[model samples]
Target: RAASYEEQGVDEIVILDVSATLEGRRTQAETVRAVRARLSIPLTVGGGVREPDDAARLLDAGADKVAINTAAVDDPTRLDRLAERFGRQCVVVAIDAARRLDGEGWEVVTHAGKNRTGRDAILWARQAVERGAGEVLLTSFDQDGTREGYDLALLRAAASAVAVPVIASGGAATVAHLHEALGAGADAVLAASIFHDGDMTVGTVKRALARLGARVRA
Candidate 1:
């Protein structure tokens, strides 16, 4: 998949090992190492990074940046020290958030979306940046895997609250959805099922986004 993305002119690739968190292990560096050799674009790998050393191991495995979520809530200070050790540019904070039952606000979810921390998603994004996370990968768990569209309110809140770049994830089923995400203040948009299931090509999506004034290049 990463190889195909590189061929389709994706700006970058983020490879995540979803099972690692539940399994209590660091990111699969070997998997990242293989994917790195197949693409020229920057790669960000995330999964079960527990500490700065785990992140460093990913970097050594050829990932340009390392993303973390469960650890972000379990030990936010780790982000501070990681930024100090590896520079903020190499740290990406992944936020898996779901809307409250009453739909009032978003709460942070960890452990691969199994645990919900009461921390407000918007507030957490701001804190991540302040702790030196260079970017935010905001996933709306309520919208994830549904292909309905992003949670524009959640995107807007996180993007506006943080100084760092925000990448919107979950539920990009159409070009219009991508446009809406960008318009809502997300710096980038990420889709999994659309591309993984062969519903859309990166080139086609990029062209579509460009028509919507996204400045995408061929």
Candidate 2:
């Protein structure tokens, strides 16, 4: 699947073991090594990044970046430490945010989205960036796997609050949805089922986004 996405002009790929944190297991860096041996585009691996050592192993195994979600919330200062230890460029802070009432804003979720931290998502984005996270992987739990659309309001708020790049995830049902996300200040957008089910092609999406004035790799 990683190789296929590359053939379709995907500039980068994110491979996450969603069960890592919940299961208390380490990231499968060996699998990353296998994929890295066959790919040219940058690869990001997340999950089970509990500390600086986990991030280090992923990098050593050939991952260009390591993403942290539950660990970041479990210890907010971990982001700072990871950035300082691994360099901010290699650390990505993944934030799973669920919409609050009326979709006015969002709150952070941890433990693979099963636990709410009661932390303001926007504020957390700012704090994460300040603590040395080079990028924010923002996922909307409310829209996750729903194929409805992205939470543009929440994305705008989070993106506006941080200077680092924001990678929007979840609820991308179509090419237009991805385009709208980039327009809403997201540095990049992550789609799953839409691509998995053949609803869209990466090359076509990139072309369309470029035509629509989005600064995507064409």
Candidate 3:
């Protein structure tokens, strides 16, 4: 899917295991090696990256960058170490967020949304950047498959909190949603089910984003 998206004029790709950490699965270096051999664009492999070794191994296996979620939330020093070793541009912090039922604002989730950290997403994003994360991938678990729309408020807050770029993920059902995400301060937008299931194409999204005056490579 990432390959196909790249063929469709997508700028970059991010592949997350999503269940690797929860299932105690190790990072798939083979998969990254294979994909790196096949694809020409920048690729980010994430999920189950708990330490700098894991991150370095993935990059050695052909990943241009590695994303950390559960591990970073639990131990932010790992991010600093990765940045110090591989450089900040190679580290991205992914935040799995959801609206707390208690109206405590957006809370960060872990282990594929099975555990809520009870920390504000924006606060955590700020900390991640301060601790040396180059970018943030903010995903809304609540709106993931619903395709309703992006959690704009959450994106806005994260954008304001971090100086680095923020990639908005989850609930992008239409081209309009892409526009809204950018308007809310997202530097990039990621969609899975919508593109994986053939509901929309990356070319369509890129065209729409371009029409809306967003910067996208040709």
lDDT of 3: 0.88
Full candidate order by lDDT, most accurate first? 2, 1, 3
Which regions of candidate 2 fall more than 4 Å away from where they truly are? 101-104
Best of the two (1, 2) by lDDT:
2
In terms of lDDT, the best-performing candidate is 2
C-alpha lDDT values of all predictions: 0.89, 0.90, 0.88
* lDDT (Cα, tens digit) per residue for candidate 1, span 85-157: 9999999999999987777899998776778788888888899999999999999998898889999999888
lDDT (Cα, tens digit) per residue for candidate 3, span 1-218 = 56777788877888899889988876899999988887899999998999888998899999999999998888889988989999989999999999998877899999778898898888999988888899999999998878899999889988988889999999988888888999999998887787888987888878878888888878
Candidate 3 residue pairs in backbone clash: none
lDDT of 2: 0.90
**Can you tell me which runs of candidate 1 are displaced by over 4 Å?**
none
Off by over 4 Å in 3: none
